[model samples]
Target: MPVLQRIVKPKTHKGKRAIVNREPKLIEDLKDTLCIKGSTASQYVNNAMRDLYDLKKPSAALLQKKNIILPFEDITPIENFSRKHNAPLFMFVSNNKKRPHNLIMGRTYEHTLLDMIEFGVENYVSLKEFKTDKISTGLKPMLVFNGELFDTNHEYGRIRNLFVDMFHREVVDNVRLQGLEHVLSFTAFENKIYLRSYKVSMKKSGTKTPRVELVEIGPRMDLVVRRTKLASDDLFKQATRKPKELKVKKKKNISTDNLGSTHGRIHLGVQNINSIQTRKMKGLKKTMAERKEERKRKLPQNNDTDNSKKAKNN
Candidate 1:
């Protein structure tokens, strides 16, 4: 009997955005089967594409308008509008230098401006500092909290409390937060806190556990602590300080004057006596000389006498 083979259908697309090819007959069959009307196949294709891409319609939270204000000349904008709208206003500095960007968010315009100054932005003039002539000199588009989705009074207070609580609990407990000597910074996302401490770690082992040994002092650590604030400044300082130097007792040197003492003479005499006894015992021990003497005593003076007597008899 002949072996049978089954035909496999070709897939229309692969990976994320790859183009898919479909049989012309299959497309026509789908249209006819669905009783699609008119030449508007584009709409049907669009809906199918949306389903294939797993895209969902924007929710009310995302659709809501945000309070977008312009920043001062020394400040920059944070393009993450979604995250900005949800949490308390804070400054976000990008880690990437090639795409340098900074963002400030706060409950009010004044609060955000104050934070900018606090975080080392120089020559920043507040709104009051600006004369009517200089009003537009430093202005740029910046995002502020819009009261649509987030209530200014309640939400701002909540965000502030959340930040303070997280800082005290997560950062203070786990890391040494030193005053002036160390810098502590944090970022909040969703319900989690990303706490970072810049201080010398004295741990000697290369493993991940924190240590206090001076030999193990390591570079800065960027840690992600949970929402609960466990870190404290005092605790961190106590843990990371340089360990005390170990004191080793020095060995006492022997005096040359004691070399000729009675005890030393006695020890030398006992050693000499042991050497004489060892020398005497060595003679009594079985040796090659003793074996040669015994062999001569056992062998024949009789053999030579017997040989001489035999020769006389012959």
Candidate 2:
């Protein structure tokens, strides 16, 4: 099915500017997720989508209960929705007799379905289950992936990258200790992934750094990995491609080390063998006789400079 494009007739200059700003660029803006609820969405799916939308904050877009199947069956509808909303990432929540409490999480590339990983949500817990204060929306949460499989196994590695891509916010050089309010941990064990959310509590210690503690928040779930449609190597490469402008222009013959020290190679041009006065290197070492000759050579030039200065005065 062909994706339809909607044209807006902007009456004001600001509206026109907004339309123009939405066009594609060399460096795209932070990705917004589309939280979709299928026609057969259960309460568990609804709650999960709500919590995910909270994590994504103002950048998330939602769709009401729609009669739609997942990408594994047919990806055209999913692609259409992605193109219409201009969202690269999506979290689809639905339930069926075959795949109960199914959650399809994936990302799009160039309005096409890139990679879709299906998970069966089990042992679901909602946000209201815990009577703790919720972290403010839009604030970045620290994501921790704790699993040996994440580094060893290829499938778990992909899953780790997906979670990081979904939850990570803009890069910042420095963060305040107080600003770390929440942490989301994805732990893989016993053939299932455990998703846990915690509120960071900072207490006063007798030192400069505060005593930190983690309090259990809600919206937790144990996800059983089901079907997965991974993109090919070439396609995945295209999706993860970075613009040249975004890459730092490297300085020639300069490098850094693990200890964070900047090292550079100094390229020297041809030097005049007679001009060097160093005696440290054997090739440039000056004998006593050579030193005497050098002083004698400088004496005449020094006298000439003094004579020129005197002539200028005259």
Candidate 3:
């Protein structure tokens, strides 16, 4: 029997995986606005989508302690909590009667305490003031940042902003360090704030070819905050005290006669005195020589000599 032949059909090609609908006018408008070729529209959309996605997502490091706030009675418990959780701590002490409430955030309780002392907060209670249970249990909002977008703003943002300002003032402004791109990020753990600063540059990565990267231009500083009195004008005045006037020793006037034969040797060093004396002697000698020359020139033709000779002759 003559065998029957089976025909193999070719697979049909499916176009692009993603499909987006838009008005004809909108598509034309986007093309004109972007100033791109029709063929590159998909590529442009892909890039824009990627950027939008990135904006929507929070930083990985930042999200770890998103809504965590541990409370403690003493440094020992705070230290223990931070160590156990491996996160930083934040404490805000406010006096309703005063303005500029204290915003304290640090890696450790010890660091926070030191910072409080530095801020001149002598009378502060760690546990007595704050209800630790409320904070840890999420009964109340742990952090409240002052700005728009309350929903997006979190403890990390508040702490980052505070540290960035402080870092810029103390390190970039006071120390006058340059090429300080910005505070990359900060970690509060182990009772300290680890602030990382970077100098962003395009440099060669081993090979001749260069790539953009962040180079750490430290001090990866450890910051601390302590409990203190509420912020006030008096506190600011105390913090910014005027520099003490320098006590300059008054130089006693020394008499030239007291310097003896050296001629004011003590007042005007040996070299200076010698120069002065030489200059004076040179001037005196020049004047005396000029006077002697004048006398010699006048001796030949003098009215007094002529009168005396004429009188004698008469």
List ranges where model 1 is wrong by over 4 Å. Answer: 1-69, 72-84, 92-314
Runs off by more than 4 Å, candidate 2:
1-19, 267-314
lDDT of 3 by residue, 1-314 (tens): 99999974435332121111121121111100001111112332223222212221221011212122222234444344444333333232222223222223333322232222211122222222332221111011111223232225343343444343222211122332233233244555433444443444556689865676665543233434443322244543453344354344544653345547333224443465554545445545667778899999998789779999999999
TM-score ranking from best to worst? 2, 3, 1
lDDT of 1 by residue, 1-314 (tens): 99999965546445212213221221111100001111222332222222211111121121212233333343233223323342213322221232212222222221122222111111222222223221111111111222222343433334444334222211123423322222234443443323332333344478876464211111122222211212244643543244344334543542235456332222233356554644357557878987899889867786888899999999
Best by TM-score: 2
Q: Residue 215 of candidate 3: its Cα lDDT?
A: 51
* lDDT sort, best first: 2, 3, 1
lDDT agreement with native, every candidate:
0.29, 0.86, 0.33
Worst 10 residues of 1 by lDDT: 28-37
- Runs in model 3 deviating more than 4 A are 1-197, 200-230, 242-292, 297-314
Per-structure clash totals for the candidates: 19, 0, 11
TM-score of each: 0.17, 0.79, 0.23
The residue-by-residue lDDT of candidate 2 on 132-186, one tens digit each, is 8889878889999898988888788888888888887877899988899989999
Output candidate 2 Cα RMSD: 9.1
lDDT at 192 for candidate 3?
A: 40
